[model samples]
Target: MIREITEQAWSACALRLAVDEAALRAVAEVESSGSGFLPPPSQQPKVRFEGHVFHRLTGGRFDTTAPRLSYARWDRSKYAGSSLGEWQRLEAAVALDRDAALKSASWGAFQLMGFNHAMCGFPDVERFVQAHMAGGDAQLAAFASFVDRAVFLDPLRRHDWASFARAYNGPGYAANQYDRKLAHSYARHHVPGSGTKGTIV
Candidate 1:
């Protein structure tokens, strides 16, 4: 996907996120197990397939019928009721409204949303995803902002894992899960330049 979107950009993004070769490799492992940039389509779930699971897992405000299955079938009217400044849109399921979110949300790589793209100054969701795929400084900046603002500096910057998870996935109840993922990432590999020589905190 990175090669298909932007060949030159991915290198730079990888460097920004990985301070060294080992760290970079570890990040790759976490991202896709050193496989192709785009995960297999089979890995993607249809809409609502996991909606109830999400609801039960987080008790979030997501509707069980929020229409998630296919990206190639979005309709316009369905876009109206979503939250203001939605993170991303389903290009196929939505009618392509100017105010509708970008298609990046459906892609779900990096777990990024359309709102994050706009906040980071990308013209649209495609641009944001392309930046990530291409591995440019812009994507790194955006990812860093998300981590610093929404993930690490929110109301739970100190130790509220729940709050951190909510920041990652909105008002959901899966903060603990996200925290565990982050912890695993940090433990299995260093957080880039989080430490020098022998320190990793």
Candidate 2:
């Protein structure tokens, strides 16, 4: 999947975020294994896990305080909702009809949510999904916005490859999975999201 998209579409949007072909290829594989319908790992707080049970039990700060209330009845009730993994959600979302697709959720190639998608500059859910589905450069640009903000700006911009990868994929994610992936593609690749040190894009 990554090969198909990057070989065709990576260049189109990669320039916008100054990401490397190698890095984009690595990220695409890490993110979805190149499958457009796979879900992202669940990064939402546990409060969202229990859903309404969490809301009623904890008075709405469930994400932050749920661990403390593990003994509550509501905690047991938290199982009411289905725990959808990242891949399941992605498959369901992409297979939906147009109206259902737009309203379902905003996760795309990288599992970016509604506000994140909009903030990253996609006009709407359709645009976000379409971009990922289009593959190649279009998907590259959409996913790049996520990389730029989360990984590039904060730590990567400072020439901290390890830190940048950690920030992008959660702590240790970059080191364990992402870095090695890129190494196979380009030997001289610099860490992305940092200041100008090499030819960008």
Candidate 3:
């Protein structure tokens, strides 16, 4: 079954993070197009396997044997191009090294990387994956925790999309115009001077 997050969960997350609902929604929209999981039949939480991360976590152990699953650098061309394909890549990597595989993928709507499990309030990557697999509510909760731990609330509150994108997506965020996308998404969801705490509408 595909478990989705309700509007209430979004509002609650925004409230917990002390940011406008639109701001949080903007991040979610950009991260996973506003859905935490892939389409049903699988109902699995969306994931993007990062071969570079796997390579780093495994010390390039599988680079020669599994070049597609473990590379020294980020290679967008290696992606399977669909959620299903991505899952296959992940499974293949998991067979090689379960911990490294789990830690290499970005999970759920917010796309919190598995390596960030501790920062996102999970004790380990496995626990983080379990929570993401649970439902969108858990994903949102993890996002809130990540934002809190990362000190991103100030940027969100100030509508500082550039800073938020840079911090969240790293220095390469400019390549994908993540800041601009975030600003546009926020504009679409935010109501000016509404004095609303957590209402997207």
All models, RMSD in angstroms = 10.0, 9.4, 1.8
lDDT per residue (tens digit) for residues 1-201 in model 2? 331344335555445555545455544444444344423453321111223322343344433543322223433343334335423433433343333323334343454443345655687656665565554445556666666674465443343546656666557565366655544433343445542222223
For model 2, the superposed segments whose C-alpha errors exceed 4 Å read 1-3, 6-8, 35-109, 149-160, 172-201
The global C-alpha lDDT for each of the candidates, from Candidate 1 onward, is 0.39, 0.44, 0.88
RMSD of 1: 10.0
**lDDT tens per residue, model 3, 44-71:** 9999999999999999999999999999
Instruction: Give me the overall lDDT of model 1.
Output: 0.39
Candidate 1 lDDT by residue in tens digits, 81-155: 432222233433244232233333432323455445666557766676566555323443555445544444443
- TM-score of predicted model 2? 0.47
TM-score for each prediction?
A: 0.46, 0.47, 0.94
- Can you list the residue pairs that collide in candidate 3? none
Among these predictions, the greatest TM-score belongs to 3
Model 1 Cα shift for residue 156 (angstroms):
9.3
